[model samples]
Target: MMKILIIEDEPSVRVGLSFTLESKGHKITTAENGLDGIRIFEREGFDIVISDLRLPGADGIEVLKSIKNISPDTGVIIMTAFADVKNAVEAMREGAYDYISKPFEPDELLIVIDRFIKHKGLELENIRLKEEIRERERFQHIIGTSPAMQRIFETIEVIAKTDSSVIIYGESGTGKELVANALHNLSPRKDKPFIKINCAAIPETLLESELFGHEKGAFTGAVQRRKGKFEAASGGTIFLDEIGDMPLALQAKLLRVLESHTFERLGGNESLTIDVRVIYATRKNLKDEVKANRFREDLFYRLNVLPITLPPLRDRKEDIPLLVNHFLKMFGEKLEKSDLAVTPGTMDMFMEYDYPGNVRELKHSVEMAATLCKGTKIERWCLPAEIRGDGETPDAVISVFDDLPLTERVKTFEREAIRRVLEETHGKKKEAAKKLGISRETLWRKLKEHGFPVSPSDLEE
Candidate 1:
């Protein structure tokens, strides 16, 4: 049930609204004037406040402003006479959620109230989810509050003590390495070494030496004996990233190591006993690779013991705001812009865009925007061209442009376009000019006309 406040100068109207709302399973509070309603609302918070357009002491607009100032999320609806519809519209602009005219049936007002309740329900649930996510935001550099991420976090904790091989499956930049680290950090071997190596980054010719270590003179460059990742990570955890890209020959050797506690160093027959745990991450489907004869079936099955799949950024949109806040704070501190903030448009775009590169792309985007921002606020123009689009105007920008004359509006828009292009090109006039479809001379002319901070150095570039 909702707590509703009704403000009407007419005693009968106030009484009628309160009775009607109470009958619909709402706890109603009534006031004969706007001031009394405001007092009661402040004393006792409400889910909604219904006020009359014309009232003594303060009008409905004043009441709306007061309600919003106190509680920004509370729904406010204005009641107006047919003749005072203009005032009702004005009230809406002042932040009234909706308005209904006098002589309306109770059903009409009830419909508006019902819509507000439903919308409020969703908003409250969103707030709850965010709060729940906040509690787990810094889960060892991995962030997720959504059910998808929470389940993964739980799984990580549940299996932290086990020494099983974990194969993380996710697209690039989905924090696979972070998961590996968490597994090591929370395991019984937390105090031991946690070595990481990228199989795909190291070449095939040197991969065997990298994984199994090598004796002196094993290769032309190997002048001295060196311990491999597995040897170094003994009594700890070894994370093998992009193992799917490992050559078939290397796969067989790795499979041998997985099945045995001892491995031989390159160019040496002596065996070395191992007590290290292994973790693997890849973006490819190993079963398909096995079918294609690019990966060994035995190794795939052995490494797939405790698999964890990380959801992509698009699939976990609920985490975007958390991730954005994280990156903004991180980049803001690095750039020394402590109070960094984003415009509504920037956040709106962040929520709507499909981040194909996952969290890494989002991190880079926030960093770029923070660096390009003239002030603490990251605007829609500060976003990458691909995310915000070069020609797209966000609602906030459209509203600002709506107040300008046609000619001046066009001039201002051009000025902003030039500024964004220049920022993206790092003050390089040649590239910015080309992006704007103009030459250096035209760009320089427009920059001057737009009151840009152009100097002799600008022309040289």
Candidate 2:
């Protein structure tokens, strides 16, 4: 049921409309004047308002404006006499949903109310779906559990509540953008726009217009006026990725905006003020670039206000198992291979390898393995050559495992020995157990403990 408010100077008309709407299962509130209607609308949160165009103390247009100012989504229908149709048209222009003449039939009002309800329902549903997508993207795409990542996450939680300018420092593919996104999503301005610009992606000649907007005929191809990322992100955040690569000339301009919160579009003399938080990410060392005279020192300090450095994946090898499992479940459902599993040998190889491209490389490696593997289990052969550790001797493997704890060392050695025996026997589990001098049930227990499949399909030799 809906809440309907009727505001009419004529008591008979107001009561008649109220009775008609109430009969349709809608709760009705009738007011004798515009002031009383506005008060009732504000206090009771009416879904639809019907008001006479001409009123006593205040007019219907005034009440309409007041209601919209408080709740823009509230549907308003102006009730005007035949001679006041011009005022009704003016009300519609000022955002009145619809207008009905004073002598209108009850069915006409009901039809408009039904249409508004359907439209509102669809709009609310779209908002919910968008929020769900954003929630999944924010939490699922970012994978990390190391101490370094935990510190970064803690910093994000603390600083996201503030409107501070932040600088995220990390190597390429280290998920700097993911950190920036988390900060935006957790901030007060999450409902507003989040504009992202790759400083290195666009040419230097066009970078300024992309950041500060451009007027018509601003340049050779500026045929129409356009608002840039800063203007679009007026109430939210603007993420500047690869900030170190931005031209030195543009860096000075960006610094000016950061300090004053104002900028003029290209070929426009009028300055425009904007309210936006800035987040910068870079793979290069800005201090070194400043010393080398490639980056402006002032701009570097301005962007480095709240610094967060993300650790490389090789430094957080402990997270590989969790990340592997996450991607396996993700891609398994994505690719329609729901029962896929990686052998313990493959996981050991992954744990030992160094990832220069960081988490991005690991995700891609898993995706590729899942896509290309024909069997239910992912084997060492399904992995990339560098990740397989094929040429590494036992001593070399020991060196890689040296930094891990004693328990991890034992697990790594056991996984490697079982893998080698399984390979020698062409994935015959019983024969491989005999070769490893362990019983079949014991081998199965070890495989289970190491996240390997104990069946023939899990071997994938």
For model 1, the stretches where C-alpha displacement exceeds 4 angstroms are: 1-134, 390-461
Clashes of 2: 0
Worst window of 10 by summed lDDT in candidate 2: 132-141
Superpose all Cα atoms of candidate 2 onto the true structure and report the RMSD in Å to 1 decimal. 17.6
The model with the greatest TM-score is 1
- Candidate with best lDDT: 1
Ten residues in sequence with the least summed lDDT for candidate 1: 390-399
Candidate 2 per-residue C-alpha lDDT over 340-437 given as tens digits, one digit per residue, 9 for 90 to 100: 89889889988988899888888877986786555589866556556876686656655665888998778777776776676568668878878888
The list of candidate 2 runs beyond 4 A from truth reads 1-140, 390-461
- In angstroms, the error of model 1 at 111 is 43
lDDT of candidate 1 over 21-112, digit per residue (tens): 89999999888888888999999999899888889988889999999999998999998899987788788888899999898999999999
> How many residue pairs in model 1 have overlapping backbones?
0
